[model samples]
Target: MTIERIRVLGLGKVGELVAHLLGGAGFEVAGGDLRPRPDLGFPVDVFDVGDPESLRSELDGFDAVVSCLPYDRNLGVAEAAAVAGLHYFDLTEDVPTTTRIRELAVGSDVVMAPQCGLAPGLVGIVGSSLADGLTDLRRMQLRVGALPQHPSGVLGYAFTWSPEGVINEYINDCEVIRDGHRQLVPAMADIETVVISGDRLEAFATSGGLGTLCETYDGRIRHLDYKTLRYPGHCDAIRFLLDELALRDRRELAGEILVNAKPPVDDDVVYLYAAVEGQGPDGLTRREYVRAWQPIEIAGRMWRAISWTTAASACGVVELVARGAVPGKGFLRQEDVSFDDLLSTPTGSLFRDEVAVA
Candidate 1:
């Protein structure tokens, strides 16, 4: 049977990008958002995710649904998609939300895939692909960041994407496999510095980057961790506010302060670097480096690095589903797609040659 069409839920930056990318690739793409979006430049139906009956009606006639809504709202959309028998995909990093989606996928006829952005998305795919070939893995580190190309503020960052996600990354408890034990480490801890592509960058513990790798590689890898990369002094300042000022307890007020204070930007850069060292049959070997950065332009628009990576990564997975490259049922992880498969995909191929390592 010919696939009918692909519907993207949420017309935010990421959702809009997904719609355009998929539409341009020949899929009949439609979009839904809670609020009317005049800036979308295309007609997008307004659909309330909170109203299940309305959401189900809106999702009808589509072969798949890609949610770009907040992490908390994703499960509702996923449920609506399942009831409609449409494939489901999202860019959420919240572990609990993802667990609920997985449960919703049980005995379903459609697929449910989440964490399709930079860290939980391509980083998991690339990092796990490297680990798959290793024997006796010792230490694995994954670092990803999206920052403005030019900074004029003291924070040295821009609100290119979700501010709530940024706050969650800073304040949420992080998962780390240290000394052969899985444990929770407070976010923004374990600060460290590294150089990528001749530029100095700082990295620290962040939530949700590991995805399910901790469970997948548990008791096998000695030390495995994921960190968010940032410019110098970025982590220190954030830590000062979230920790020293005790803003973690007041995320809403902190988010307001950040949104009103720090401006967003269009010209931005995304940094992705992973290192895996282990002993193999031949001896000791380490695969460590960064991907070559390729600026992205979509729908005659140029987005900052964060927008490019996050949106493209998600659209790539949607393309995979449309082509039957992924399972049609059950929960899906980002690591399920190999680097080769991702590079071969029409949407994901854009990053195949763009990765550079130090």
Candidate 2:
């Protein structure tokens, strides 16, 4: 259960930060990418991520492997980790990918946890904690948004994270518990207005943000759902691109076009909101946790809010596994993660600190 050495796959924005945070927390960390990244302050291994044999060979000596690769590249990395008998973690929001990883975890000696990032990871943890305090859980609503502090153009968005991932979430079918029944609904179908910190925003159904909470809370909570928040009118613009323009049929091209139009922004804000309504000791009650996080200084360097928040959530879960605070074998569920334990870790404390709202 003592994880000393970790091998991080991919050296992108979130991946690099994850390695840095784990190293700062006293883990011997190294990185692997298609290109050389010697400037990451750790050893870097250049290898073909698509080749399964190379991936398994690279993961041999590490106690665990964290895959920050794109959602499509994670299954191979996860398979390699399983073969090496290493605990595995990933930031994938793809439902089919997580389902396959769950199959890999069965009867395995190491843990296989996926979806350990912002919406599916942190928001799931927060929502579950709030639900635990209630008697008759009626509804659980979770929302998260990563956007530029200032915006222009019709979209009013930036690609602070992966453009491919965003496009996948936008067009995929969402799973939710509606009217006490588990069902799949089209993404962007249910739109609602949400206000946070005097800012008016819109939220709509998104795929994979709920993680495993739909199954975990099925038949217990009357209504359970998750959504991605955006500035008003943003959803309409995206729908026009995917539906009216027929870009949903060509997701790769859509991603390329969107990223070209709205590149990643340095000054970004991450908004998180979770509310649980049920029966309390007094009567019907509602409990909510809301926070607005901005870019932060860590390890003497500034990190984008989206990057740090996602990295912190992944690293915090890894830290918990290292300390035996959670299960070390089989599949790990984000809803099962204790929010208090996450806040106690060095990486998770980054979320504990607040920043001025933009």
Q: Which candidate number maximizes lDDT?
A: 2
| Candidate 1: segments with Cα more than 4 A from true spot | 1-3, 38-42, 292-294, 353-357
Where model 2 places Cα greater than 4 Å from the true spot, the runs are 355-358
Q: What is the lDDT, from 0 to 100, of the residue 23 in candidate 2?
A: 98
Ten contiguous residues with the weakest lDDT in model 2: 349-358
* RMSD, one per candidate, in order: 2.0, 1.3
Best by TM-score: 2
- TM-scores of the candidates are 0.94, 0.98
Give per-residue CA lDDT, model 2, range 70-147, as digits (tens).
Answer: 899999989888888899999999999999999999998888999999979999999999888687788999999999
Give per-residue lDDT, candidate 1, residue 317: 79
Per-residue accuracy of model 1 over 1-358 as CA lDDT, tens digit each:
1345888887876778888777877788888987887776456888688998888888888888888887778888887887788888889888888888888889877788888988788898889888777889998889898877776566788777778878877888999899999999988888898787787878899899888889888999899999998888888888788878999888877877887787677777888888798886678888875764545766577766676677778888777766778775788888787777777776777786575665
Candidate 2: what lDDT?
Answer: 0.92
